[model samples]
Target chain A: MRLELQGVSHRYGDERAVEEVSLGVEAGELVGLLGPSGCGKTTLVQAIAGHVRPTAGRVLLRGEDVTDDPPETRSVGVVFQRSTLFPHMTVRENVAYGLTRQGTDRITACLDLVALDEQRAAYPAELSGGQRRRAELARALAPRPDILLLDEPLSALDRTLRDRLRDEIARIQRETGVTTLFVTHDQTDAMALADRLVILEAGRIAGVDRPRELYHSPPTRFVASFLGRSNSLTATVVGVDPPAVALGDTRVTTPELSGTEDLEPGATVTCHVRPEHIVLSNTGGATPADTGFPDSLRNAEEKLLTLAGEVTRVTDVGHHYDVTVQSETGTALLVETATAPPPPGASVTLGVARDSLTVFD
Target chain B: MNWTRDSRSGYSLERLLPVLLGGLVLVYFAVPFLAFFTRTGVDGVVSGLSTPEARRAIRNSLLTAPVSTAVATLLGVPLGYLLARSSFRGKRLVEAVVVLPLVVPPLVGGTMILTAVGRFTPVGSAAYSVGVPLTDSLVGVVLAQTFVAAPFVIVTARAGFGAVDERLEQASRSLGHGPLATFWHVSLPLAGRAILAGVVLTFARAIGEFGATRIVAYTPQTAPTRIGVEYRRAGIDAVVPLALALLVVTLVVLMTVLRLGQTPGVDPP
Candidate 1:
């Protein structure tokens, strides 16, 4: 079943909460709605679940118009950020609450899916935070709804619990094969769980792509800044032939922009590349004072653009080092390194390839 | 001196002031009830219980008060839910109207009811012609008690329903339960304590109602009305036993209701 929204827009009084937004999710595909807080991801999910009515749009479930259908008729199973398990009821009864006639077989199956079969007789208050979330998941899943809506389901749990439960949800979602829409503000959670991520900005779609694609090729400034740790710097086009842009005192080549032959020189553009792509090496030959047209990046002839900087700070983050370098342009670029980073005040060379950059006007 | 903390155990002068004041107030309140046992011995209570008028009033109050309480709960629970959940224009005004009965004097409410359904009025006459008179009958007593006591249910149940997270309702709805079913299954059960509190308060108010009961249906005397009648015909000494009997009955009922409300996770017997 394909779920689609066409030009969905919702307003709270005169203030718009969700603008003309449209997206589609295929059957059994887990698509994540990712954004910062107050970006209308929840509102969009609500519209799909029929909890909220879009001021102007159509919601189609499997090519059938369900725009006017109430939430009860929409067959959407939702696990809210907070536990919605009926407190007076035991875990088994909570799971079977939506089963129309207290059917126990489906309830047992759903509880087994969340690994909560042993705690069936316990009330919601007796369960831990993660256990309560699992119970809520069982309750929502027992009904076998057409669509499953998870809204920040593991957000309230601790870090270790959140990771474990997020993985659990992903597994359950795959096994159930229900068309699931997971909404979260956590980029890491979205990347880890979603097959595709829809990044929203101020109630509109910023970008929609697979997590890796969006991570490497964010189309907008918001998406670039939101998806991961990226250093954004202003670049002015200094050459059109082979497409080279000036980065502070050095000229860095950008070879990946499509139709770049016609891009005029002196055009101010914004370019961003992830911290891992920015290669920070100890300044062995070129000092901060040593300036040249084409700087040496580890003495390689591969023409990788290099900039001179001094290491400002270094912090080991288990698998990598977060080396903060202050370049001549007064921009602080974060570079991730597997090797031991130089101490503060050591001059370093930051190199990046032409194809690793994302340039936009 | 530590204002909130006391060094002595149960015999400090610091605690004695508030205790003394509380004692004075308690004495002021409890002296009248204390007089019930002192003034009326077991013989008087048994004699009062044996009186035909007192027995009739007790039976009448027991019947009518429960009817009004049941009716109030049936109507007030939904109204409380609506008030707690949704926002519309004049919501504050609607709330004020609902709670007006609690704020206004019961005598004033009784007078208002009397004017609306006093035999000559259109509704009153139509009911009277149809042999369903609203005045000087048990139905009239119930109507008066419902007006005064129903607000207790609305106010407490509103607090209960308000405590329910809206997300729970949304989750229930998304789970294929309509609004009514969601209320019964999710909202009502989650807010049972508050709803039960409201019903208990309504029961207390309805059973003890006197001013409105007198104006609407004085002939079908409730417990309070009988006490008043006995006081006027005889004296306070004669009515102490009846008041004591009413108190015992109310205490037993209140205790049962509170016990039932607290019995969570246990199957209904």
Candidate 2:
């Protein structure tokens, strides 16, 4: 079923929790609402589930207006962060609870769907964290809701279990073709599980796009920083071409920015460069002077703008070395390096390719 | 550091204090009842039991107490649920009013009821028209007992309902159960223990009620009233056996009810 929210707003006294937010979820599509704590992601989901009546706006379920309907009449299934299985009931009983309420047969089939048929006789206390989460899922799915709402469903599990169940939940969503809305604070989860991601910030939609597009070309600095680690540099735009931007002694070009026509001659802009895009040079052969890059350095200088500093720390973190470089400008930059990492107090020049730098106006 | 010996000593002392205090209090209360039983003996107790007045009092106590408890449970449980779950203007005031009976002197409560249900009032006149007299009747005793005891049930049941997770109820609602079904299936079962505890407490309170019964309906002569009458007419010696019998019966019932409360899964037993 397609779920559409139109101008949904909510308030707790003077503080607005959600404000004029509107979004849609297509049938068989899993859309994730990603935001930080107190960002109203959960509030929006609650509104959709009819738990919270929106102060304004309407909720549409497959073209039917269910704005004023009570939660029990909405027929939407929800799996909460805390596994809300009835504590006194066994796993089987908890899973069958919704089904029995609907007077449906084949309760065992629902248990089998979440792979909890064996643990059905076990109480919630006896079940492992992942097992309990699975049981909660079974309970939610047993009713065959038109829309499934998951509010940080995998957050309570440990890392390994969270990763396992996240994949399991995605798989289940695909198999059942349930129109699903998942809310989570983890960006990795949103990117991995959601076909489309809606990034919310301060009770409003910051951006909404496909996962790949959102990661590759984030619309705002907030989206860019929230999605992954990016080195931000403040500079004034000196010149602009279709695909190339010239900033105070530095110019970077990217094909993704080729169609931009709004760049002016002199304007303050923020530059975003992923840590992986910066190439560390021992011989300084790939410096801006030699490679036609707009900016160049005389040596590893001790200034903030200069990507030149002594390595204060070097710790190998399995896949990458977490390198902390301190400059004379009193600014420190945390860089992730996968290649040869310098030992502590070692000097190295950092080279950033032009195409790898993203300039945001 | 000799930690093991110190720990053992501390644990033993912690265990001993409550046991010693509890045993002392038990003997203090049990001695008089025991004295009454022994002085009357099995033959005297049997002879006391054969009295028509004793039989009527026993029937009155049995008949009135359970009926009062039932009335309290029927009215109090739903009121408790509402108090716990809903938010409204003057909710705290409402709660205070419900529990007013608990703090009001039992005689004062009986007087309040008498004024409200006596022949001078609308309720009393309606009851008189229907040939139902609440004053000096068994029904009056039951009503007085219920008034004094209902607050116990309401308070316990409110706590029970409050202990239930609202999320679970919402989850049930989302699963297609209506409001009433959700209450029946999720809310009540989860709060069952608290409700059972409330029932036992209300029953005990109603059975032991003396002041209200005395003021409202002294004619039917429930056990407590009868014991009071015997004490007045023939001194403590004359009423000791009946008092002892009532005390023994109430203690057994209370212990059984408490055991039921402590039972796992089903709320006591």
Candidate 3:
């Protein structure tokens, strides 16, 4: 079923927890609410679940308004961060609890769905963390809800288990074809599982787009920084084309912006360049003449920006070495190098790629 | 090394003082009860049990305590669940009022009941008009016992209801059960242990209730009031056998309750 939230706003006494938020989820779509702690993501999910009523808004389920409906009346299921399984009931009994209320037969269907059929007789306390989470999910899904709200379903597991359950949860959602809204602070999980990402900041939507689009072309600085690491540099605009910006004898281009109508000459602009795009080389190498400039001329015309500093540290982080390059500009730039990293106290030249720099006016 | 030994000695001595004092207090309390039991052998116990007044008192105590406990559970369980789960205006005030009897002395509670349901009051007059006397009757004893014991059930049941996770109830609700059905299937089952504990505690409190029953309904003598009356009329020897009998019965009930509390899977009701 389709779920739509229109002009949703909620206030807790004096604090405006959520404001004027609107979004929609089509059937079988798994959307994610990505935000840090206290960013009102939980409030938004709770509002949809009818646990918390919005001060001003309407929740539409399949074109029917259910804003004033109580939680029991609304056909929504919510799985909390902590697996709130009934401690008194066994796993099968817990799953059957919701079914019995619906006048459905108490079968092993739900237990088999979550792959907990073997442990159906186990109590919640006897089950492992992952088992309990699956049990909770099965319990929530037993009634065939129109919407499923998952509040950080994997936040309680360890790193390895979280990765395993993350895929399991996504698979379950896809197989069940439930309109699911998952909330989490972990960006990796959001990217891997959600069909669309809705990043919330300070109770407001920072950005909402497909996972890849939101990562590759963030609409706001907050979204860019929150999604992943990016090197931000301030530059002055000398000229602008459809996809390139000239900044003080340095021309940089990015695919993020297709046109530059918003830019003005000499206006200060911020540029974000991914670290992997920057190429570093030994400074004494001969430069190709025909491709760019003559070797002697290139050597004579020193690289406009060169930071000469001793490397304070080099950390081998699996695929890349994080080189701590301290420049005379008094700023420490963390440059990732796939090659042999310079040892501590060795001097190196830092080169930033022209095409990799993303200009934001 | 010397300082460590001295410190250890000091700590041991400090621990010993409380243990000694506690042991002494235990003996002080137990000596009278032990003496009573010793003086009243099996014959005296049997003789006490055979007495018409003693048998009547035992029957009254047994009959009224559970009846009052059941009454308390019937009224207190739902009230406790409501107080624990729902939030409305004046909820805190209502909670405080429900637990008010816990703070009042049993005799004072009985006095309040007497004032409210005396022969001259409207309720007393209505009962009298209906040929159903309350004062000095078994109903009065049960009412007085319930007044003193219902709060125990309410308090314990409230705690039990509070211990049940709200998410469980929410899950049940989402599964198509209404609020009341959810309570029956999810909330109440989870809180069963607490409810059972409350029943035991209320029953124990009712059986031991003396002051209230003595004030409101002295004719139908429960064990405590009967022991008191026997002591006042015939001195300590006459009351000793009856006191021992009451103590034994109470101890057996309390032990049974403790055993029930120890059983696993008896969650809050």
Ranking by TM-score: 1, 2, 3
- lDDT, model 1, position A350: 81
Sort all candidates by DockQ, best to worst. Answer: 1, 2, 3
* lDDT tens per residue, model 1, A191-219: 99999999999999999999999998787
| Model 1 residue B39 lDDT score | 85
Best by DockQ: 1
TM-score of each: 0.93, 0.90, 0.87
C-alpha lDDT values of all predictions = 0.86, 0.80, 0.79
lDDT for model 1 comes to 0.86
Candidate 1: segments with Cα more than 4 A from true spot? A258-263, A284-302, B1-28, B263-269
Comparing 1 and 3 by DockQ, which wins? 1
Complex DockQ, candidate 2: 0.59
Model 3 chain A: weakest 10-residue lDDT segment is: A284-293
Indicate which candidate wins on lDDT: 1
Q: Per-residue lDDT tens digits of candidate 2, residues A77-154? A: 999888678877777778778775533355687777788888878778788899888888888888889999999998
| Fnat, 2 decimals, each candidate | 0.76, 0.67, 0.59
Best by TM-score: 1
Binned by DockQ into CAPRI classes (incorrect, acceptable, medium, high), candidate 1 is medium
Look at candidate 2 and give me any clashing residue pairs. B260-B268, B260-B269, B261-B268, B262-B268, B263-B268
DockQ of 3: 0.50
